[model samples]
Target: MKKTKIIEIKGLCVRYNNISILKDIDLDIEEGAFLAIIGPNGAGKSTLIKAILGLIKGYKGQIRIMGTPLSSFKDWDMIGYVPQKAAHIDRIFPITAYEVVGLGLKRGIRGNNAARYINNVLSRVGMEGYADKKVYNMSGGEQQKIFIAKAIVNNPRILFLDEPTTGVDIKAQDAFYELLKSLNIEGMTIVMVTHDIAIVNKYVRQVACLNKTLIFHGDHDEFCSSQNAIELLMGEHHLIAHRH
Candidate 1:
């Protein structure tokens, strides 16, 4: 049997002040699949993510989340998002890691249950003992893990991460990817926007190479084999690898 598509985008286009940012992009992401979107800066990679998240306006296209039209989809809790690391958070907010994760809980969770849930996710991210530590007192890797724990505290079906490993240490990056892969294996669909092409290829099952458009979308092996993939990555961006 074929897998179900969790996300669908067709004829998608986004423009900013008359300048095209994403042009006629099309993509299909299956349930439980791990997909990585890669491209250089200003390549509209983030724009495409915003469009799928329904954060972009005046776009020309159709987007469906879990087979429902984007505009009509109201199951926000089914999807989770972790934006660029610490983009909207203050390191010195004085909030504990447990408190940060607790904020994403949906209504109705009792205090005891909420704390258990928070600790469970923190443990999943290998921060089991740091629950009481202040957010600012933690290292960058520790902080990123807490942020990820916050995003998944509610048990979302699909998780979207943008530059998730930005400030993480090299060792933590491996552990982080392992954590993501383990989650994917346990049936959580992951869509990540990353610049680390080489690292992503080692984990994600699919790849979507974007540069103001959908240049390539396919399985990891095919993406690694395609000459177009190398050309597109090497053509304008030195950030991506020439070979997987």
Candidate 2:
């Protein structure tokens, strides 16, 4: 049986101040698929994500989620977003790890069940014991895990991460990837924008290459093996040497 499409984008174009950033982009992401969008800097990768998240308002395209038009999906609660940085969070916010995770339940904060959900999400991310610790005191990797816990606290069906593993140590990167794999296994569709080609090739089921255009979107094996994809993402010099 074919999986239902979770995300559908067609003729997507993004522009800023009359300058084009993304042109004629189109993509269809399957339900429960782990997808990675990869490209070199200035490839409009971030712009693409912003467009999908509805952060960029003047985009020209049709975007749909779960068979409903983007405009119709009023309850964004179905989507979980973990930005590249915890931008709004203050280093010394005086909030514990548990409270941070609980923020994920923003829309469901009517009663005590929000706390229970926070605990469950923290445990899933293996940060159960750190619930009482202060966010500012934790290491970078730990902070990232806490953010992930917060993102999933609402049990969203679709999760989007932007440069999730950036600035983390090697060990932390591996652990985070493992955790993402586990989450994917548990049936959450993941859309990640990352520059880590090796990790993307190893784990992502699909790849979408963006650079002011929809260069390619398909199976991971084909993307990793394609000459064009390699050149587009790694640059022509690296691709030539990599193939040789």
Which structure among the candidates has the greatest lDDT? 1
TM-score against truth, every candidate: 0.93, 0.92
The per-prediction CA RMSD against the true structure, in angstroms, equals: 2.1, 2.7
As a TM-score, model 1 comes out at: 0.93
lDDT of 1 by residue, 1-244 (tens): 9999999999999999999999999899999999999887888987888888899999999999999999999988788888875534565578989888888787789778988898899999999999998888878888889889988988899999999999788999999999999989989999999988767657878999888988899988888777777897786555443343
Residue 179, model 2, lDDT: 85
**Candidate 1 Cα deviation (angstroms), residue 158:** 0.6
- Which residue pairs of candidate 2 clash? none
Deviating ranges (above 4 Å) for candidate 1: 235-244
Q: Quantify all predictions' global Cα lDDT against the true fold.
A: 0.87, 0.83
Cα shift from native, residue 157, model 1 (Å): 0.9
lDDT of 2 by residue, 57-165 (tens): 8789899888888877776777888987752457758899988887778674756777688888898888989999998888877888899998888888999998987
For model 1, the run of ten residues with the poorest summed lDDT: 235-244
